[model samples]
Target: MPAPKKPASKKASVRKSTKPQPDQKVLIAKDSLSHSEHFKTFLGWVQDKMNENLIHLQTPQVIESTNRHFMVSGKIEAYDEIWDEWAKFVDN
Candidate 1:
């Protein structure tokens, strides 16, 4: 048996609309937190937002959505190609 070869390059397929600007969010969070209780509340809010918007590798919903969109264009039929596109979408 032989080892599987890695992909040579990544492709773009589906994209996410929500991408948190870390610096901006942190600034806003800091501004809102004037006390310990407020800071904890703010931290919880941030964590919740991250979980809501961030894609989990083990989940299939996002990948399925991407594949559906890509099919409309008659391009990019594989899930592997969309990882970079998803990351870029989230980064923005």
Candidate 2:
């Protein structure tokens, strides 16, 4: 007589990859804009603004908002002009 096999787990087993992670700056550049409005839009926007190149892997958090847009620390001044540049960067 053969023994019965055990049932599979309800939760799938996830294997962690040992491969090196994709470049953070590249990842940011590859990201698309969520025109619905969110902080990620700002990250993608800044990456696009970095001389039309990706400059950061992990973007900063939103400090505040006005006129309904995300804002972060300025690169050369007290603050950079606030806008959802990513919205325009996205493929129409």
In order, candidate lDDTs are: 0.48, 0.44
Model 1 residue 13 lDDT score: 88
TM-score of each: 0.27, 0.18
lDDT of 1 by residue, 23-64 (tens): 987656545443456545544554554444444422566456
- Stretches of model 2 off by over 4 angstroms after superposition: 1-37, 51-92
Rate residue 60 of model 1 by lDDT: 64
So what's the TM-score on candidate 1?
0.27
Candidate 2, residue 57: how far the Cα is off, in Å: 20
Which candidate has the top score in lDDT? 1
lDDT of each residue in 1-92, candidate 2, tens digit only: 89999998798789999998889785566463433345456554654564321233133322234311222224312212333343444454
Off by over 4 Å in 1: 1-32, 55-58, 67-92
